[model samples]
Target: MLRMEILKLIRNNVVALIIAYILAMSIGINILSFGFDELAWVERWLPILTIFYVVILIDLLFWMAAMQISEDMETNMIQVMRTSRNVIQYFFSKHVLLLLFILVAAFLGIIPMADQFGFVLNFLYVTLVFSVVMIASGVLLAMIVKKQSVVMLAGSVVTGFIFAVMVRLVFPLWNISPIPFNPFEAFIKAYYYLYLPVEPPNQSYVALTLIAVLFYIISLYVFKKLTFDRGFRL
Candidate 1:
């Protein structure tokens, strides 16, 4: 079942385009920064990863989660699929496919920085947590709001924009603690700040990951209860 889900993503034209874009950006980012003698080797990758996760993958994963499930519901394919597999199995297979995409794009973007074990480890941790959090966020939202996939895709882009603003423009400028809203910030901050020589900012992110897990649990329940019934009503 998981294999089938993965193959579906692999064949998706958008997914192919995205992977090609990742490859282009991976090389392009380096090319654009070609002559920076002052730039540290490790410093170069952060931007690539930043653009990949912050600008692209977050919304992509979210939209995929929502759209794929929404399509399944709309066509009553989900009902058919559910006959052989429980709701949990169905949703998770889709979720894991997107998660795998995230890891692929992330590793591709950060390949140059691979020698730095510390940075690589932190980035992978954040990337995994981030994939789940963003997918859950979209799936959770989609389960409640019935709409076309295009509508949801647009919403995901807007969300990615807002998240970028919050993490890049707003959060960094302020010194205020975002205890209640830390997960959003921590997803970027956890690894972005790891290269700093100070005490690791690992604590908040660990807590944030737990919160993300909670969000995912809620998303699963919502998928089962909300989406599972919609096919019959249709």
Candidate 2:
């Protein structure tokens, strides 16, 4: 089921968009490097590519998945799939596939800048986990809200709030200096302390991951009781 969703998504324009965006970001970084110096370019551009812009791009994929799911319900496809064993697992698998797509796109986008920026495997792991959680949360929001527009609005608003409040405001205060191999420090502190050398992974990555996971789990429960009208009734 997951494989099917992934293959279908690859046929869409989203993949092309990701590739084009990555190319553009890389080119922009190089062009800026000649004018501003390598360190400045990393500070100004890398975070935009790796964190901010990446979030918006991945949100597009999330929206696509929501629309696809809604379409399936409208066409009775979901009802048909529901008859199968482990239907919820199949639904969740689609979210997993979308998350993987986001992560791969992000990594590939960052690859072009690695020579100047350096790469951290831990950053990739945290980013991957964060992407997965966002994808799941988006799906869950769509299922709960039922109305497409409302789902999107709710997801965006809630996600924005969490990013601004929880990830940005809260995590920085935590003390993880004493614990070596601290996963929290590995992810968030890297974003804060190691800003340029490797384009420090966003300090909010770990917090975002946790929030997304919690929302995803909550969405699953809501989806279990959801019923689709199949007539654009929303």
Candidate 3:
């Protein structure tokens, strides 16, 4: 079933789309930063990378979740699949596929800057954690809405609102010197600290991990509710 799901993603051109988007963005960012001092370029582009990573990557997850869920519901395949397999395991397989997509995308996106930035593991770690949260959220949204168009619309609005709130309000309020409170702000600070000599506090890592876990737990609850209570209704 997992193999079938992966093959379906490829057949639908979803894999190609994700690869193309990540490569395009990475190439574009690399080209744009070409004449600048290497360190300066990384410094300037880090925020852009963060923004792009958050918005586009999350949007891709939303698109995939909506499409996959809608197709299953429309074709009534989910019902059939659930009868034969553990529904939770089936849902988790979707997550596994999404995580694979994220890993490929992140590698493509980060490779261009690796030589210049010296391969920041923190960037990859944070992105993977963020991807988990986003993937779970996307699946939850798809399960609740059960309509591709509505899922896309609502996902965009919700992500946009999150970006706005984090950048404009949350980050500013919590991005204190030496001890940042918000995970997004910590991400930014951690990125800078990678290049600069300053060491990021351990609390940032702990906090982000905890938040991701919380989001994953909530998403699972929503998934269970949809599977059992709602019967995965469309």
Candidate 4:
């Protein structure tokens, strides 16, 4: 079932196009930067990782969920599957596929710079947590909005807004202050607090992890409840 789900994504033209675009952009940037200064590759890795984390990762998960679930619901394929398989199996399959996609993309994006970064465990942990949060949010949004187009638009806007706010908080100017009680800001802060030189309160780590888990649990419950019926409204 997981194999089939992955194949379905492979056959999607939009997915293929997006993947190609990412690869081309990554390669092009690496080539252009390498020509200017061979020793400055390490400096390039941070921006690449940041772009992948803030935009590519979220966009990929959102579109994949929208395509896999929304399209299946639209065609009534989910209804057929539900007759034979439990909702948990279906949901788990989707989650597994999503994780696989994220892992593959992250591997591709990070491996080139891994030597320079020197295998940071904090980076890996933060990436895993961020992937879970984004995947859960994508699945939840896909369940709520059955239309792929709307999901794509809504996800882009929401992810962009969150990314912008978080980026501001991370690289704040002298006079700027991040919004108080911003969960996204806290999440990014916790990430940097763990890996970077900054020393945030220890509670930041606990709070971020708890928030990620909470979102995952909520997504799971919503998915199960919705799939219990006709498998999300079309």
Deviation of model 3 at 79, angstroms: 5.5
What is the model-wide C-alpha lDDT for candidate 1? 0.65
Q: Estimate every model's Cα lDDT from 0 to 1.
A: 0.65, 0.55, 0.63, 0.63
- Which parts of model 3 have CA positions greater than 4 angstroms off? 13-16, 32-43, 50-55, 78-84, 112-119, 165-203, 228-230
TM-score, each model?
0.77, 0.62, 0.73, 0.77
Per-residue lDDT, model 3, residue 44, is 61
Of the two candidates 2 and 4, the one with more favorable lDDT, higher being better, is 4
Per-residue lDDT for 222 in model 4? Answer: 77
- TM-score, prediction 4: 0.77
Please write out the lDDT profile of model 1 over residues 1-234, one tens digit for every residue: 788777777876777877777778767655544445256763555463454444466666777777666666566574566564566766767877778777877776666568888887777777788778878877766665555446454565447553654555334566644444434655656655654547466557668788889989987776766666454232
- List, in order, the clash count of every candidate structure: 0, 0, 0, 0
lDDT of 4 by residue, 89-194 (tens): 7667777777666665655544444675644444555656766787777777877777777877777665665666665754557445655554455555554553
- Over 1-234, each residue of candidate 2 has an lDDT whose tens digit, in order, gives 666666666775645676687667656654554455457645665554455545555556656666556646556564546543443654666766766666666665455556644354555665666555556655665666665556556656544543453344233476423343322233333433434454444445456667656766766555554533232233
Of 1 and 3, the candidate ahead on lDDT is: 1
Ten-residue region with minimum lDDT total, candidate 2: 176-185
- Cand. 3 Cα-lDDT: 0.63
Off by over 4 Å in 4: 28-45, 48-55, 78-80, 116-118, 169-171, 174-182, 190-195, 198-206, 230-234
lDDT of 3 by residue, 79-173 (tens): 65666355566666677887777766666655545775544566677666767767666767777777765766777665654465345522457
Alpha carbon deviation, residue 134, candidate 4 (Å): 1.4
Runs with alpha carbons beyond 4 Å of true place in candidate 1: 30-55, 76-79, 82-84, 153-183, 197-203, 229-234
- Candidate 2 residue-wise lDDT at 124: 62
lDDT of 4 at 86: 66
